[model samples]
Target chain A: MLLLAVKGITESNRKFLSQYDVTVVTPDTITAQQIPEIVISYAWDDAIGQKILANPNSKLKWIQTQSAGVDYLPLKKLKDFGVVVTNASGLKAIPIAQTVLSYILYFARGLNIYASRTHWEPYTNQYLVTELPVLVFGTGRIGQQIASHIRAFGGTVYGVNTTGHMVDGFDEVYSMHDYQKALAKSRVVVDGLPGTPETDDFFNNHFFDQVNQLFLFINIGRGTTLNQNDLLAAIDDSRVKYAALDVTTPEPLPKNHPLFDRPQVLLTQHTSWGEYVNAGRTGGLFRLFEKNVPSFVKSGTIQYNIVNLDKGY
Target chain B: MLLLAVKGITESNRKFLSQYDVTVVTPDTITAQQIPEIVISYAWDDAIGQKILANPNSKLKWIQTQSAGVDYLPLKKLKDFGVVVTNASGLKAIPIAQTVLSYILYFARGLNIYASRTHWEPYTNQYLVTELPVLVFGTGRIGQQIASHIRAFGGTVYGVNTTGHMVDGFDEVYSMHDYQKALAKSRVVVDGLPGTPETDDFFNNHFFDQVNQLFLFINIGRGTTLNQNDLLAAIDDSRVKYAALDVTTPEPLPKNHPLFDRPQVLLTQHTSWGEYVNAGRTGGLFRLFEKNVPSFVKSGTIQYNIVNLDKGY
Candidate 1:
């Protein structure tokens, strides 16, 4: 079987994957006509989607995207070819969860404010900071992990999920319908949902206006899921004290971008996932695939496969 | 039975204690001449020590100090009176352990430096930063807790104790004789030893000079146990990169002290045991005491209550 290794898998990881009976190919190294059985598309939003679609062969059994979201993938075309689509959904959960908790704690206890202001003077007033209650959207693996860590650090956690399945560590779990209730009660709101037509610009002017003005917000999932204009207005109106963004629209946000210049905004260049210690490794992915392949073959169901094309993730 | 409500134990706590067949008395409220069955002294420093000694307590059968350190309780007077001495020895273990781990991650990963620096600029330079290892002194309740938390965060943990008992979480547990060896290999050294005559100035200039120059050190134990001169020299000679002190000599470190002026130093006015969310009620110590009191009454020996008068705690 052939597998495409995109976004430059580490040399150490590549060496390990070479041991398996898999031929690693890059988009530059192959043509659409010679479609591999397992097409590992790194940039789901790029030409890779078209490339896979061009190959109308039933031989292309699986499309393993190196991302949690597949909004840009040609789902209809893949379906036509009877291609199963699996995603790197759980891979980013650890780092993203860590980043969310870091920001929540930093904002809740005013650590960033204390660190920034107390440069020349001794920290006297930093002692008066108070704790915050957090409401996290998309209580999937990433959100659940975030809730667990935040609860461990003494923050009250509430989550919103499609199914409203009660998460183990959250103080309260709510269905997606209870968004307004969650927002009303939270001092901080974290947007961790995938970008879908329904979810895009979910944090617009109306949504931000309703959220508590004292709320500190964060977005680590999809950048387009937020309305940039509403976010700026929220910041200007003091509705949102600060917003720490890991993923942003127009990636590599230009230095002069207003969001970058916003006093309360912290823009991290999509580096939340794949950090220094636990960067993406193909060997780990291959091991996951090894376990998943037999189950899929037996039951005709891909465990992490994303469906519901309209929902986009 | 008589129970002395020390350490400003609130009327609420005293009321709770009164549920048992015990009478509560404070030092200021009760005369020493009219000594109760047991005198609970919270502070064992010079000022409090002289007060206790001034009271010739002929009827005092037991002395239960709220502090873990029995150094200043006039142990000699208690010995002369044949009074059984017990202390709230493990009260601060969990909190101190939480603090130690907080500093371990903060220093090892250079979180403090990053938090202190201007993170507005993009990050460059991709070389291995530093190896993280922590050496904990006094492998007692607090030290072991620190080790457990540090190890949980993927740090290499080494410990030093009097008995050299094998601790599960630590990579290596060494006796006092092998502390130098442990220190030599550690990236950070956490002082958790109680303040005794033998431990006073325990982390001297000589000891600092023997370790790596890039090392980080912290003291969450007794402030008087450390030599300020050695700490100053360690910073001056570049033997230690930085020192995070929760406890410092002459508590509430004077405004213009050199250590306060040092940029590398992070001083937290010995407030690690502040009544924060989970900390206000660290029931571990109380639970241990409540459980062992009956056992002590039956067997004449309590677990973890070994206090040697010669070396005070």
Candidate 2:
């Protein structure tokens, strides 16, 4: 099987792939004549991916992404082409959950105030996470991991999903239609929803206006799910007490953007998934790829992380 | 019974104490001739406490402190006066433990690096708490709470006390005499030991030299237990990767102190115990006072956090 890896796999991983009778080629080494049957790419390589997809002689049957979110991929085109799509879901769960906890505790313990202090000024606006009732927007792998961690700290976890089906680790689950009740009780709101047309601008003025009280806001999921202007207004009106965003629309969000300078905002530049050591090669992503490869070789499909092309994850 | 509460009791608490037949008086109301049988004071009321204790006609039989640590109190003099001392131990456990976790997660998620960033710069030095093995010195209420929180994140918790006896919430327990092995394996070290003569400068240069690797140091314990210069030297030599101190000797540690300016150090200005809402009056201290009031009124002595005046905790 010919596989084209735009980036992320290491030299050692390339050697490992050799044992599977799979030939791996990078963008530097790939020729127009050598159309790969499988392509492994991350979100940023879309331009190169477009060129390969446009090729009339392209033999691509499946695209495996290194990112949990495949929002940046040409989903409709891939759907039309009948190419199977699988993502690295659950690969970044641990680190991303840890980052979410960091944001929660950062605001809970007033580290946001203490971090910039040059003199001895004790802050008292802090509260314990145990007192926080958290409402997580998505109940998938990442949200579940986050809920488990919050539960460990004796905090209440309220999960929201398309269906209100109860998930393990969450104290309660609310469907999208009935989440307003949970939202009213939660002191902390976390956005773990993926970026899809349905979710784009989901957290806008209408949503912020429903918040019952001033609360901490955290975004570890796709940034497109939020309206940046609405969030700023929420902060201005004291509906959102503080916000820690690991993801933002137009990432590399302009250096002079208003969000960058707000004391109530903590922008991490989407580095939540960057923490895992050698993430692409020996870490979770590689392990996930290793699990899917043998099955993909025998059949033209993968069972794990198979995104519904029509619905989009 | 007459009780002198220098501070911390609210008007509502005073009314509640009335049901117990206890008359609460502040410094302004307590005349020299009006010697109270019991006193409630915090760490900062030492001068007034000294004056009250020096009154030869004093009927003072007990001192109930709002602080967990009694290091600032006149322990020897209280012992000489045959005064029983009880502190608000376990009261600050939850919030203090939350603050400790905040410190751990802050560094683990690279907030220390990203916090100051004005532009989009992703950092890769972040690691999950699960990857860190923590060794906490002192397994009292606060330490155990800290252990449980770390363990919840799948991190190993090694506890150290005077005895090596196993404690709940700790993965392993080591005695002060034999903590070197645990220390060597730990990537994060926390000082939760109380301030006492024996614990003075316990974390000196000799102690820091025994560290096996570059580690994160956290002090939620009394400041006197740590030797600041030794810690600074360790940081300079790269034996200590980062330090987050909630307690520091002579805090409001001088505004120009080197520790305050170091990029690797996070000085929290002794605010770990300050986060509780209305901490002095309606919070933990007052709750503790209420619990102990009934027992003290029924007998000459009360239980719950009785301090060995000679030991100074």
Candidate 3:
């Protein structure tokens, strides 16, 4: 029996999974008793998910996540128990790239100001996306796709990675040590980095202060990596002009949070990588689950997108 | 001597035209005496601009317009007077395409809905630009560029033209007669067609009624081509969900108009073909003027982008 944590699984999806005996578990009802059978933690991003992972469930062979970043998962503990993990990474690249471009366009096209205006208030300073320089934090699937999308719009993409070996689609790659140089050329800084101890709170005040021509800060990656207080400080000092945040520190971000009220902050509530055509958000999540199940059933090994325990991504 | 009608002629621009004897004329200041001496009517587009063209000027050899569409001008009379007409067509294509994509992304990324939401209310029906079928009218520089941009985003593009010969970047091409067949498949319809007598008020109730799933009506072209009554009627009947109009009838569209009040309409107020990085909007116009000046000086002829009198575009 497979424990499915994804909510809003349509009837058609259940019919598609007719071959497997599946148990649906929501945040409220998931218990330690069901932990061992929980093969997949699809769409798992809440505190209740912590308990499910914490309970020693030896039978839990694989945890397939709908999110690209597997940072929240207790990967080190899971690895000790020989549990394998895979993420829905490639499926989200398009939507996330679109979201990033939307952020750039929101400012570059002057939509941020124009959307609120009741009368003609055209700004003299607008730019083509091709003319702007964008810096992306990761060189993985999401990073490459975002770079390609920005390039398509005629923007220069600067990628930052550990070693900074040449990456596809990016105009230039900056090593971890020299990333500040790359950031200096950029008008837009995009966080596509997965969460790791190295990445935690990396985008603090100092990071924002080093930025040049800072128009927009985009965080489509794990939110834990960005310091919101520092971001606000940067905004206040005009080091950072605006922010388009898809992910945040606290999921569902308490209703009374200041980020919700700030005009400069486009708080997306983490809905960037979502639905296709008329399909629901679960369509991509379900597709990822279906793709992984066959391999897991045959080899009892996860071959694709298996997260590194130390990296926690 | 050339008649430069464009405002904001910066010092750098004057240096670019150092070889020519240029006479600047504002719309309010231009008189019949000045019109008679005007050898070239560059960047002409106002009511007095029409008067400058209508008043017989024997010295006039070329009439240059900064607009992509020449439909508003009296093309037949200009041609009859043995004058060549050039336009700033290619310059606006990129910005115009960017604007159209902004509208698509606005809806696709749920920015349209999310922008208005006072609280967190993320919609699940949003789509990637690449997943949708985009219907484009007119297969010129602007249309082809728009199609290329959409294709880069992973969307299918349907092109409609007079003959509908195979065009690059478009997934399919439909003849003018068979455009309705293509429109039925698209949720987004982009009007890039230049205005002409044959195309006047072409987008009326009948045009909207044939649309199967009209999610957005994007006009980055001339406004005279679209009938406001039909667009409003289409919106009232729920056939058209939203509109992103970059151009409109009697622009500077009187303050109290309902278009400003409507949430669904993204009235850009003719600001789509806007600023470049260091180059102003006049960069392309200047380049066009610079290109034509040398040739006209030598051969007494303006060659490139000379509008065909019969086409009125």
For model 3, residues A101-157, the per-residue Cα lDDT tens digits are 877787777777767778765564677887678989999888998899888888799
TM-score result, candidate 2: 0.93
- Of 1 and 3, which scores higher on TM-score? 3
Question: What value of lDDT does candidate 3 attain over all alpha carbons?
Answer: 0.77
Each candidate's TM vs. the true structure? 0.72, 0.93, 0.89
The alpha-carbon deviation from the true structure for residue B119 of candidate 3, after best TM-score superposition, in angstroms, is: 2.2
What tens-digit string does per-residue lDDT give for candidate 3 at B1-313?
Answer: 6564654566776665556656566566766677667777777656655666666645777778877788767778787887788887887888878878888888778787767555666666777786668999988899999999988877899999989798988999998888977887898998887888777888888898887458899888789889987898788778998888988897878877777777778877777876565444566577666787777776787778888878876
lDDT of 2: 0.82
TM-score of chain B of each: 0.82, 0.94, 0.88
The digit string of per-residue lDDT tens for model 1 on A1-313 reads 5666555555655665556544567767866555535534432435655655665552566666667777767776767777677777777676566556555544443345433332323332221112567888888788887876665555588998887888787888888776777677787788898878778888789888886575578998789989887899889988888887877787767657788667577665665553444433322454444445555445656675555554566
Clash pairs, candidate 2, are none
Give stretches of model 2 more than 4 Å off: A8-20, A36-48, A55-57, A279-282, B10-20, B36-48, B55-57, B279-282
**Residue A299 of model 3, lDDT score:** 63
| A1-313: candidate 2 lDDT, tens digit per residue | 7777765577887787888788877777766677434444422356567777877556777777777788877889888877888888898888889999999888888888888888887777677787788999999999999999998888899999998999999999999889988988899999999889989899999999988555688898899999999999999889888998999988778779999878899988777875545532426666676777777777756778888888887
Q: Output the better candidate (1/3) by lDDT.
A: 3
DockQ of 1: 0.12
Model 1 lDDT on a 0 to 1 scale:
0.64
Candidate 2, B123-233: lDDT as tens digits: 777877877889999999999999999988888999999989999999999999999989888889999999998999999999989874555999999999999999999
Higher-ranked by DockQ: 2 or 3: 2
- For candidate 2, give the lDDT of residue B83: 79
